[model samples]
Target: MPAITAENQLALPRIERPGPESRPRPAWLVTTARTQLEGEGFQVRRPFPGLEVGIADPFLLLDHIGAVEYAPGEAKGAPWHPHRGFETVTYMIDGALEHHDSTGGGGYIADGATQWMTAGAGILHDEVPPAWLVQKGGLFHGVQLWVNLPASMKWSPPRYQDIGARAVTLLASFDGGALVRLIAGELGGHRGPGVTFTPITLAHVTLAPGTRLETPWRRDFNALVYALNGRGRAGEERRPFGEGQLVVFGNGDHLVVEADELQDARSPNLDVLVLGGRPIREPVVFHGPFVMNSREEIVQAIRDYHAGRMGHIPPTRMDFSHLVGEHIDQDRGGTRR
Candidate 1:
C-alpha cells in the first residue's frame, strides 16, 4: 500500500511494440486434471506443487491452486522463491494466506480477498498457511495467474494490492445470478478493479441453472473461459464445459454462457473465470520463475538473486535455500537446464 518512489519507478525503460492484433492465441493448452500434490511427501500430487493450466500466450501462466481442504497440523504449501519480468495475481475464494515478500511487503488475505503482486525487476516471496486456519481445517480455494511484463515495465519496482470482496463491483444480474468484476476492463456496463498495465479483463461469475450471461469484449484480444464449478454450455458451438476445464475462444467481441437444466441444481452456482489480453509478439525466453525477451535477461535475473539485489530477506526468517536448491536439482534432472 506504499507509494513507489520516483527513483525506483524510473529504472525501467519504455519500448514501443505491436499490440493484440499482432499476436493471436497460439493453440490453447488443454491440461487435464492431474494431481499436483501427493505421495512423495504430502498427501496431494508430488512433483509439481501447483495446478498449471493454459498456454503462455500474451499471458504466460495461470495456476488454479489450493482449492481443497487442509488437515490439522498437516501443513502444505508453496515456499519462498524468486520471480522476475511478470505479475502474480492471487484471488482467494475461501480460507486465508499469509504472504511475505523480499520487497518488504507482508500481509494476510482472508476469504474473497485478492492480491496482485508485480515482480517487475525481481522479487522473492513466500505464501504459507497460517496456524489458525490449519487448526480449523476447512476449504482453501484460490487462483494464481502470472502475466508477463512488457519490455518497458520489466525493471519497474515491484508492487502489491490486497483487494477485498466488497471493494469489487458486482454488475447486473441474470435471473438472480451475479458477476463480480475484478481487475482492469469492463463487463455488462460495469468496470473492474485495479490498474491497467495491459488491456485485459478478469471476472468471477456465478450463474444459476438455466441462466444465461452475455458480456462484451475487444475483438482483437484472445479470450478464454475457465470453469471453476458446475457444467455449462458456452458460445454458439455449445461446447460442453465442466468443472476444472479451460475453454479458449477464437476472435470475438463477446462471450456467452448458458447453464444446463439436467445438471444438479443443488450446487447450481457455476464459478467461471474469464481472462484475456492483447498478446506480446516478442520472443519469450523462460527459465523457471524468470521470463524475459532474451536468455541474457534470464541470466541477469539469476545473478541478481544470488547477489541479494532483489530486496531484503523475508521477515519470517525462514531459510528457504534448501527447498529452492532441491527444485533446481529436479529441473536439471529433467533436462530443463
Candidate 2:
C-alpha cells in the first residue's frame, strides 16, 4: 500500500444511513441502557458509556456527550473553556450546539455537522445550547475528541472549520454496510474532510448485523474504536462491547469489526467512532484545558488569556458577566492550598 499523504489522499464518498437489520436482539436482552448526569447531561447506551477504552498511544481523550433531551433555557451545557497544544473535534449526531470563541469565530452546528478546531497555541471557547434548539427540546447527541498536537505544531496559529454534513464523503462499505469519513485522514481508500496539522483519522461508522468492516491503518499510528450504539466484536480477541463503551486495540496494521447476526432489530445498527494518530513522544504539561510542554508555557498561556493577547473577543453584545461568578467558584473548588 502507498503511504497516505496530503497530496495523494483519496476523498471518501458520502453514504446514506443503512436500514435496520432483521436479527434484532432479544427484547429481554436490554438493547439500550440510559445514563444520566446532574449538570453535564445524559448519554444513551452505545459504545462504552464513560470509560476510556481503545488505543492510548497518540490520542489523549474522547468524550461521547448527549443523545438525550436538553430542556429549554438549560444552562447545564459546557461553559467557557480553554484549550491549547491540541485539536478538539465536535461532531454532532443530533440537535445542535452554538459555539463562540475569543478569536471572533462564532457559529451554530446542527445534526451531522463536524467542527474541527486547532488550539495550537491557545484558545478560549464555549459550546452552549442555542435558543432555537432550546425551544425544540429534542435529542442532543454528539462526540468530542482531543487529539494531541505534535511538538512541531504545538505553537502554530489557532484555527477553526465547520464542515456541513452534506460535505462529508462516504467510503465503500464491507458486508453491505456503509461508513462516513469525517475529519483528518482516510480509510478504505477514502480520504476524510478537514485538513489536519498531524496525520490522523476520524471516522463515523454504522454497520448492519452480520456485516464485517475492515480498515487498513498505519502501523506506526495508535488507533482505537468507540462504539456509539449496538453490539459487536472487535480485533482478534472478539471482545463483546455494547453501547457507551470503548475498545482499545494494541499495535496493529489493520482492524476488523464484525457484527453478530444474533443482534435483535432494536440492536441492529452498530455505530462507532474511529480515531488514530502518530504518537508524540514528549512531556505533556496540562493545566485544566491548556496543555503545553512545561509549566512556564502554561503560565504564559494564562497570562495571554488575561492580557487579551490571544485574540479579540466576539462582538455579539451578549452579556457574559455572570460567567465570571461561575469561574470564581470553579477556581475556588479546584484551588490547592
- The deviation in Å at residue 149 for candidate 2 is 1.1
Off by over 4 Å in 1: 1-33, 38-56, 173-176, 319-337
Task: Tell me each candidate's RMSD, in Å, in order.
Answer: 9.4, 8.2
- Model 1 Cα shift for residue 207 (angstroms): 0.6
Residue-level lDDT of model 2, residues 195-277, one tens digit each, is 88877888887667766666677667766777777888876566677677666666555776767667656456677787777
**Model 2 ranges with Cα > 4 A deviation:** 1-55, 73-75, 264-267, 328-337
Candidate 1 clashes between residue pairs 3 or more apart in a chain or in different chains = 36-45, 37-44, 37-45, 38-44, 38-45
Highest-scoring model, TM-score:
1
